[model samples]
Target: MRTSRVDTTIFGATSLLTLALGGVAPEQITVPAPVASEDAEAVAGLWLSADKTVRLRLDADWSYLGRVAGRHRAAKGTYRPEGTGLVLRDDTGLRTPVTIADDVLEMAGHHLFRA
Candidate 1:
């Protein structure tokens, strides 16, 4: 009688690499983490909803946009500070009101947080 054994070594190597990338590679990367200078806290980074169903991001270029559950485009617009609130203006020229309190962002009766 003859018996054969199939190789499983490749999967093992892939699994090890995946874990190492998660646990070790991120630290070894040369990219610098963002620092919150007083000016930086003014704008930037990922934002999301209280229900975790929506997400948004702001860049220094004055560009702002939002997604639904990190998948579909829900809102995209330009944003700027107006007093303590933010004004989100869509391409259609429609404007929405956004307020930031502590770490929570309130807009259209939905609450969001910095993520």
Candidate 2:
């Protein structure tokens, strides 16, 4: 498993940027996480909707925004999967709890914004 320190740029809810390790330019245009393996491979992509909602894509980059009508509405932070939940770091660097199961995510704070 490659646990190297990668450059992760956190954009607010309005814009999004792709992140990659070392010099390996992001092959895809979305943020990915490790799935069914110890190594961080491209599993799924995440993004916001036109109405400011959070959405997750499988095996592809974010295509468009989502509708804003969820618990994570107007949220912003750095998201990383941890076991059965996602670790969401808000703009203030505060760690918020987020649970992801069956392709649906539940959050305790507003963290559905883009990266």
The candidate scoring highest on TM-score is 1
lDDT of 2 at 113: 35
Clashing pairs in 2: 11-115, 49-65, 49-66, 50-66, 75-110
lDDT of 2 at 75: 40
Mind giving the per-residue lDDT tens digits that candidate 2 earns over 1-115?
9898988876643333233244344553344343433322333456433345445332232122223465554445445657655565656677755554444455554344333
Residue by residue across 5-113, what tens digits does model 1's lDDT show? Answer: 9887654665676587885644354532332333334657888887788777877766788777646546777877766677788777879877767767788878888
Among these predicted structures, which one has the highest lDDT? Answer: 1
Candidate 2, lDDT over the whole model: 0.45
Pairs of colliding residues, candidate 1: none
Model 1 Cα shift for residue 51 (angstroms): 1.9
lDDT of all predictions? 0.70, 0.45
TM of each candidate vs. truth: 0.57, 0.34
Q: How many backbone clashes does candidate 2 have?
A: 5
